[model samples]
Target: MNRRIVLSGTGLVSAYGSGVAPYWDGLCSGRGALGPARRFADAPGYRGEPVGEVPEFDPRGEPRKSAYARAALAEAQRSARLPVLPPGALVILVGQAPAPEGGGQLDGEEWELFGPSAELRPDGAAVLHLSHACASAAFAVALARTALAAGAAPLVAVVGASVLNRYEYASMDVVRAVARTAARPFDVDRDGISLGEGGGAVILETADRARERGLRADLTVAGAACRVGGKLPAASDPGAVTDCLRTALAEAGADRLDHVHAHATGTAQGDTAELAAVTAIAAELDTPEVPVTSHKGAIGHLLHISAVPALAAAALSLRTRIVPPTPGLTTPEPADRVHHPRAETPYPGLRVAAVNSFGFGGNNATVVLRRD
Candidate 1:
């Protein structure tokens, strides 16, 4: 049986603030939240790059990642009206672990930071932790769809969180991937990525299960694809990304797309490569004027959990029939093939959207969401 997977609820915590309202508002406002680094401003390797730190977040006591994850999960549960995780529920935690020398991985000694503890997981619930760099959340969603199709669980909750720590900051600085100011995806003068910290969660269940629970099941996970392009950590293959997008659309049986949430992280190579793939996909779909946007310009790159916000944005676009604008895009690079909106655009026929997330090591993932 081909089980239909649907997105029942979504929760997000970004630099704008907690909840979907604030995040959506921030995106539509066409303004970025990136500012001076508050946590690592005085770090040894810090070069005064702006960051998208969560407002009023205190990293003094408990792990900031854990707190963000829990808050996002709580919001997701509330949105789904799931007071407690049901028996046999599957929880997928997505995050990247710090280097061994810098500190133990989040799933290792720092397991409590954002592990599937008793608080987040019930007695019969199963847990899966994914640390596949930036595409971790998209991979989790793909896995959740597979598991639901196989009847492994009635529903799946995917939660991901990442914070701007000194170690990661230093690593980014070393790679020169951190932008000097703010992220300007697809802009002619785009520099690099602006790091951001936050958590996001999305609840997925089979269509039958959602109907049983009396939850709205309009937003469906039409398709998903993950592809490994090359060995380089910071570089991506346009061909691989094109194949990934083609496969996702093929799986979704979609010939047209209403919106595209691209993984343009403001890096010259990354943005250009993604634009090439997106352009190819647009040409294939015969929708040369397809609207595309990137959340990184506003929220900064969320690293391992980047896909969550993109997925959230795509889903909300389907529901609201509005395409959110891309922030920090002043002079768009010459791309007449696609429309990059800098202001909120109404798409009355918005029914299908694709969210792309390309991680280090050429880990590229795409999720096609549809509204019935």
Candidate 2:
């Protein structure tokens, strides 16, 4: 029997607000979680303005954590508590290492960026740090599906959390220049991406278990795939991205996609590559009208927590039937204009959606989703 993979629950933490309602409210209000930099004490020479900083929560050390990682876990656990849960569950995936252990100065971008942090703990549950950069969370979701299928764990939690550190802020110029501060999927002025930090995780199980516990069985994780983009290296390359999307579509057994949740970071190269992939896919058929959007325009890049927002966006599409508009896009990019959808929430034409993500080390992952 084929195991049914579904998204049971998700908990997210970001600058928009710490919980789901806050995130939803921000989205509805056309507000993005962007603000001045606080990642480091002294970010010399770097403007380091307006990043997606997860609000610092410290209830007099009651939680014993202060960074993004702890906030993510606590919120996830809290969300799980409200929902029905199966016993003897396991934490199979962690978006990145614990923040406290890796926490350090906002000093020179190098030490901060290349600094050694995020390690493993013996007492911690079987943990895998899925830090393939931006696609980290997507990869974790994929891992959860496999773990359940292989019987490695009955109940698995995939947690993804990220924070805008000093080093990351320094890299923003490159990102901003590419997406033009507007993340239009098929828009022309796409400059690059904005940096933000947050946490989003899922506690998942087989369809049978979810049914028994009366959990929300909203959508099924139909298919997923991973690849090393070392060959592509740049996040803005068409060949590898096209390959990644094709593989994901194939694994999901989907020939036609209703929509695409683009990994468009607004960077020139990234946009070019993603558009190339979409065009390639579209060309295979008579014509494709799949509309594409990116959450980055609103939330900034969630780093390791990237997939969670994609999950949130996808979930919203599946639940409410309304596809939110692409925020901040003044003009749709020529690259992204092919067969793009222009409807808002309750997008009448959505069925199959693909979520694409890419990370350093040439890591790319694509997930195909469907309403269960």
Q: Which candidate number has the best lDDT?
A: 1
Which stretch of 10 consecutive residues in model 1 shows the poorest summed lDDT? Answer: 109-118
Candidate 2 local Cα displacement, residue 117, angstroms: 10
Which candidate tops TM-score? 1
Question: In model 1, which runs have C-alpha deviations exceeding 4 angstroms?
Answer: 58-61, 98-119, 231-235
TM-score, candidate number 1: 0.93
Give the worst 10-residue stretch by lDDT in candidate 2: 114-123
Q: Assess every candidate by TM-score.
A: 0.93, 0.83
After aligning candidate 1 to the native by TM-score, how far in Å is the CA of 267 from where it should be? Answer: 0.5
In angstroms, how far off is 3's CA in candidate 1? Answer: 1.8
Candidate 2 residue lDDT tens string, 272-342? 77877888887774344566777776777877668777777777676666666665555776753354434
Per-residue lDDT tens digits of candidate 1, residues 275-320? 8888888887788588899999888898888998998888888888
